[model samples]
Target: MAKDDSDIYAALLQAIERGEFQPGSRLIETELAERFKVSRTPVREVLNRMESQGIASRDGKGGLIVAELSQDQLGELYDIREVLEGFAARLAARHAAPAEIELLKEMIASGKLVEGEARELAIANKQFHQQLHNCTHNQYLQQMLSSVQRSLALLSGTTLAEPARVVVSEKEHRMLVEAIENRDEDKAEQVARNHVKNAYKTRLKIELGW
Candidate 1:
């Protein structure tokens, strides 16, 4: 890819992940080129790459829009997350350094200070999980999880938006960290899997307006 295409792609992807460009939002090549001070050619190339990655798709009206996952697609994504995240936790239990474990604990502590702030909590939660992914020390697993996470940006809102869900999620994070600290691979895996399961349930509630 050309430098312009790569830079534009990175900026567009970040905007999408940050909810600046929501699902179904139109992606006009001319507008993007204007925003990034680039030519239409590079914007077109970046949009093509995003479409291939399932991040953007033609809206059936000759324009590109951010992709939205169907119910079945969401189910499949969650299933992948449950298995891979559990494996990540198990590996972290075996390979994580003491300093890494301390950092996770510190992150949890910082999260508590942000209680009731949904956006901050959501960012912290992502950081914590990203750190856990790093703790696995498996580059292949990290790469896979990174892709899965990008897909997750398609979902509209944070499960942490609910006060009750936030409380339960923090507890779950503490339990998973404790399991890793104790070097109990089985417990860590189970805790991590259950965490994802609970998150899926919360996401369903949000999606269904329950």
Candidate 2:
């Protein structure tokens, strides 16, 4: 695709992330074209691509809307995330170098353990996990993990946005890294599994208005 189309798609996705164009919101080609200063042709292409990528779905009657996850789908995604990511951690432990482990350790140590920029903290949290994923050496596993993470968009609210979440999350990250450094497969898998479980707990607490 052209540069303009790429930018428009990114802007649209970011808008969705920010709740500007929320889940189930319609995508009117003309209006989005005007908003992004792009031609309807490119806008249509972007919408088509988003649909194919599972980021959006056809509106049944016409165009497209951001896809929302059902309760069952959310549970399913979490199940897959824990299994795949835990496997990634186990694979990583077998392949990771000392330097890689050290880098992960540093990231865990330096990550904000208290309230701060939510987006930045979330990005850091994501990077730490992605780095662990990278250590796996299996391209297929890497790609599958990426797809599972994209499903995270279905859930509302940043896990990092909650007060005190970073503190708890940082400790969890440390355990994951330590397990990898120790080359303990069971510990790595357990730590990774617990991390997702804790994240789901946070999501539930927030959704329940606790």
Among these predicted structures, which one has the highest TM-score?
Answer: 1
Q: Where is the poorest 10-residue window by lDDT in model 2?
A: 107-116
Model 2 Cα lDDT, one tens digit per residue, 135-177? 9999999999877776676567687787667677778788888
TM-score, each model? 0.91, 0.89
Reference-based lDDT, residue 189, model 2: 90
Residues 25-107, model 1: lDDT tens digits: 99998988888988899999999998888888888897999999998999899999999999999999999999999999998
Q: What ranges in model 1 sit over 4 Å off? A: 1-7, 112-116
lDDT of 2: 0.81
Question: Candidate 2, which segments miss by more than 4 Å at Cα?
Answer: 1-5, 113-115
CA lDDT, every model vs. true structure: 0.90, 0.81
